[model samples]
Target: MATSKSVLFVCLGNICRSPIAEAVFRKQATDKGVANDWRIDSAATSTYEIGNPPDHRGLACMKRHAVPMRHVARQVTQDDFQSYDYMLCMDESNLSDLNKKASKVKNCKAKVELLGSYDPQKVLIIRDPYYGSDQDFETVYEQCVRCCNAFLEANS
Candidate 1:
């Protein structure tokens, strides 16, 4: 393992799942008193929401859980393959995208995975709340929170 640990959360767009996962993990690390030991951020596979804030529903979901996240949307960069210890995608589609990119990098491919892999009981996508109702955001928040907590427990 690297001396310093950093994670990059990813999704199709940075507006929903990825940002929420970043916030959830940040909050989880803080709650575990390991915030100083790990770093977390998020990115999009596409540039649709580049430079934009997280989706409004996603923001509300984070606020509801007291997860503080202030992020400007950005597309995943090749440089991130070298920078982060882990690149966690919200689902299989995004994971496939990362895998293809990771394949081009020699050692970096070892560090990418699906966030659902961290789930203890069941695997699931960190569903997109963009086109859905507020409840969708809440559900995504719950899944992200669960995965984030599990990640901290296993890693720390």
Candidate 2:
């Protein structure tokens, strides 16, 4: 029996990079027929966009790539640190915030790390696209695809 793997993609606001990574990873997993072997989700290190859907630009970017993305922004809770096997974040600030939160959870199980760390291209940051042009969103989507693919490949 194969044990299901679980991961939570996280960022500062949850409206941009994290959601894209989550969607991209999920789509790739489903395409490979292994989505059932994983529990996937996304969240935020901060409360900035809680309860809100992903940014419009991100939605548009996903549409352009034919990737499905549906997520409500949510802040990371101490419980998340226990629920997920891995909690991958967009950048250093999110990584720092998640690590700080994990420190408070006495039984934290999630491994907090940068989602960019999995990028084979060596891109270390998945920038926030809330203020940038649609091109910026495209760049984020491209990076997410690369990083998500590498992460999935490494685990498979």
Candidate 3:
């Protein structure tokens, strides 16, 4: 059996950007026939939207792109710090928050980084679309596609 590599995508609320990134990466991995080789999931930096479903705009965007997305918002856990191979976050604040959390987790092994770091287009931040228009959600989706593609290629 292939060894498993896990990644956890994180954002402020979990309802907008991170879920989209998780779904996009999953679909890309699946398309490359490596979906089973990796474990993919998403979480939030804050508990504000914990237990809530992804934002409707994000859901619509995923559906439009034919990316299957199903997730409940959850705060990043200490176990995530130790378990995931990578904890990829949306923006600078998320990167800082996750690093702070991971610092407190004994033996944490995950490499926390900005997901946009993988974008070939050099878009270094995936902005939150929570209060933005539907176009903003589409932009998030576009950035995820670029970043996730490069990420998969690098890891493969």
Model 3 CA deviation exceeding 4 Å by range = none
In order, what is each prediction's RMSD in angstroms?
2.1, 1.3, 0.9
Q: Pick the candidate with the highest lDDT.
A: 3
Query: How well does candidate 3 match the true structure in TM-score terms?
Result: 0.97
- Score candidate 3 by lDDT: 0.94
Task: Give lDDT: candidate 3, residue 127.
Answer: 94
Residue-level lDDT tens digits of model 2 in 39-119: 999998888789999999899989998999999999888888887899999888888888878888988999888989999
lDDT (tens digit, per residue) of candidate 3 on 1-156: 665898899999999999999999999999899999999999999999999999999999999988999999999999999889999999999999998898899999999999999999999999998889999999999999999999889899
TM per prediction: 0.93, 0.96, 0.97
Higher-lDDT candidate of 2 and 3: 3
The TM-score leader among the candidates is: 3
lDDT of 1 by residue, 1-156 (tens): 333788899999898999889988988888877888887889999989999999988888788877897999999988899889889898888988988888787557338888888887576677677899999998888888788888878888
Clashes of 1: 0
Worst 10 residues of 2 by lDDT: 1-10
- Of 1 and 3, the candidate ahead on lDDT is 3
lDDT of model 3, residue 39: 90
- For candidate 3, list the clashing residue pairs, or say none: none
